[model samples]
Target: MITVKAPGKLYIAGEYAVLEPGHPALVVALDRFITVSITETQDQGTINSRQYLETNFHWRRRGDQMIFDNRDNPYHYILEAIRVVEALALEMGHTLRVFDLDINSQLEDQGGRKYGLGSSAAVTVATVKALIEFYQLPLNRLDIFKLAAIAHFNVQGNGSLGDIAASVFGGWIAFSTFDKDWLRTVLKNNTFSEIIASDWPGLKIELLRVPSELELLIGWTGSPASTSHLVDRITIAKFAQKQQYQNFLESSRRCVETMIKGIKAAEVNVIKDGIRLNRQLIKQLGVFSQVDIETPELAELCQIAEDYGGAAKSSGAGGGDCGIVLTDHSVDQARLISAWNQHQITTLPLTVFELTGANV
Candidate 1:
């Protein structure tokens, strides 16, 4: 059997603004991961997972296309990964074979509740990694990232694709989005192979260095929010209030740039200040959009962390889900965790997933 793993991610700063091309966001890969394993099969192939209510999916091949026994399925990203990789394989004159794919995830609770840890993106990347390895394809991490991004874009159809980059290149990264319109034009004019090889305008991913004096903490508010739904709501508000939206974007850009500089220079104060400012900006955005980006639980999460001398804010789209905190080593982490526990907030024991030689 062939196995591959991709790590989950959390957004440190620049959430809604990063959707615009060239806007930057800071994201970090977590220790948690989604693992995909594959074994060759002669006839029908199966997919099994403990994460879903319907745990088994059977499929047969019709040429290069997969015909699943049940159309209503939860493997949209996984299936898309297989389709695109198979297309690439066939384009390279490689024959296809059947395989049983197994998925295991650590990005959720035992009840299968997601922690807003980028599970979909990790699974997609893991599936692409597994198939490329299974076929012995000559592709690097960047190639896998591009393939997974394409599949994810096809399904979600929005967002910065920063999570995909974090999963591909582990650890801290400053990510800038690509021009979605340009990508659409390229897809229309070129073949899949050519599209993969072409440059994506305005997209950039640079790894970051964390200061030794800094400590990161995560708190999950027992509620999960649909990122897509939140984004869609914010988009409607953006068009209605164009000037306010533009101002928000400009402010977010400056804040993220400041944070990046701090990380690069190992200046803990600058980084923490940037986080606090970003949190206020997001709260203002919620007010103007009339959408509660930061719920009551998330507000309490941030307030408690701040009381303990940490800079805290909602991560990602943040209707609910996880909130991140940045603090110096001198702060009382034990007290902060205790405070969170009293408020029914679960403190996740997640650390930064440093990129090693073994990670792709």
Candidate 2:
């Protein structure tokens, strides 16, 4: 059996700003992961997930293509991932043999409530790794990330692919947007074989040192975020509001830069200031974009964390998902959690996941 596991990610800084080119987003890989297992099979290639009951899917080879019964499978990431790597194999003049695949995720509940921890990206990354192992492809971490991005980008049209990078190469890192326009053009214009063989010229992923004396406190808002819809709305708003949104993005860029430096240097005040400023800037984005970036509960949660002498902010796109608190000590961590509980926000069972291998 070929087994591969990839971690989920949380954005530490640089949210909406990373949508632009040449901007940095700091992301952390969490302990939770989407794991994929594959073994040689003779009859048919089947895909099953322990995380979703409705995701028992199977596929077969039809000439050179993989054919399936259901066209709109819920486990699209795995299917798309399989297709992507299959394209790579086909480009190399080989037919990928059949294998039975099983997927298991720690990122969501069985009832299908996403925790907003980049589950899709993790699934894509894990699937890519599993297929690579199955086929013995000579692909490195960056190759896996880029190929996984193809699968993810095929499914969701827009994203920085920062989450995918984090999952493929676990741990914290400073990431910039891959050339979305370039990738989109290739994905749209090129054949699957050409797309698989094409190089992603503008991809950027850099490693960052994790901060010291800080505890990562994560809390779930008890609701999921529609990141795709929110991203589409923001993209529309960026065009409509041009200069104003550009200013907001610039400010966000500065705040994220500060947070990265502070986290690296163990500068507590700089970290706190960056976190506080990010909250204000995200609110400004909400106003400029006319979208609810932060909910009342999240605002209250950040306030409670601030009151406890820690810094807090929403982790990702921020509609109704998890928020993070960077507290100085155990006392502050406990206080922030207790206070957030009072505000009806429950603390999530997550922490900063350290890498076992190379991060960069």
Candidate 3:
């Protein structure tokens, strides 16, 4: 059996703007993870997940394509992961094998509600990693990231693949999106392996070092938001308000760049200022886009953190999910948590997950 774990991610800065190619964002991998385990089987393959139900999903292979017994199951990411990895394996002169796979996730609450910590990306990365290990593929970290990105983009079809980068790299990362239009053009003229090996235009991923005194705090709003849905709405707004969207992109870029500089220079104040500016920028974006990027609960979450001298903002797409707080070690964490609880917000005890001997 081969087992692999991929950590969930949170966007620290650069939210909607990161969708544009070459625009930077800060994303960190959290300790919460999705685990995938696979073992060879002689008969039909099975997949079980308590997160889904008590039943197990069985599958059959028809010439390297997986055909599930239940076609309507909620395994789009998992199934696509299997297909992409198998395609690469076949290209490497390896025969596909039947395997029983198991998935377990720590990215959710007791009630099985996702914390918006990028569970879908984590699961997809874990599945791809497990399959790569099972087949003994000679792929490096970048190769794995590319393959997982391909599988993830095929399903989600929108948003920056920064979560996939965070899952694959497993640390604080400065990321820029790849040009999807360029990718589409390349895919039309290249093999899967060739495309994986090719340079993706505008893509960038750099691991960052957090200052010793910096502390990250996460708070849940008890409401989940659909990132794709929010992004779609923003896209429509972008088309209608071209100049406004362009201004947003420039401002977000500057804010994220400053934050990245602060991370590199170990300047907490600079980072905090960037976070504050980012909050306002996102508010302006919401006003123009006419989408509630930050809800009342999210505002409360950020306000409490700021009252405690911590810099805060909504983490992801942020109709209502988690908000992140960055502060020095001197802040009163207990008081902050108490304030959040009084407002019905749940503080998530999550820490950054760093890769062992990461190259970047």
**Whole-model lDDT per candidate:** 0.90, 0.80, 0.89
Q: Model 2, 1-360: lDDT tens per residue?
A: 878788999987888888777778888899998888999999787888756674434477999998863422437778899999988877767767999989888987566777889988888898989988888877777778878988887887787889998897777788888678888788768876565556666567887776577677888887777776688889999999999898988888888888888878988778877888887888888888999989877777777877888788887888988888777764457666787878788787887677665532
What is the descending TM-score order? Answer: 1, 3, 2
For model 1, residues 1-360, the per-residue Cα lDDT tens digits are 998899999999999999998789999999999999999999999988888553345577999999864322348888999998988888878999999999999988987778999988898899999999998888887888888888888777777899999999999999999998888787678777887888888889999988988988999998977777688899998999899999999999999999999999999999999999999989989999998999999999999999999999999999999999998986799999999999999999999998798665
Model 1 Cα shift for residue 219 (angstroms): 0.2
Q: Which pairs of residues collide in model 2?
A: none
Candidate 1 stretches with Cα past 4 Å from truth are 54-74
The TM-score of candidate 3 is 0.93
Candidate number with the higher lDDT (1 or 2): 1
Model with the higher TM-score, candidate 1 or 3: 1
The global Cα lDDT (0 to 1) of model 3 is 0.89
Kindly list the per-residue Cα lDDT of model 3 for residues 1-360, writing each as its tens digit: 887899999999999999999789999999998999999999799988898563234577999999864322337889999999999899999999999999999877888777899987888899999999999999998999999888888877788999999999988999999999987787678777998889899999999998989989999999977787799899999999999999999999988998898889999999989989999999999999999999999999999999999999999899999999998976899999999999999999999999996422
List the RMSD of every prediction in angstroms: 5.2, 5.7, 5.3
Best by TM-score: 1
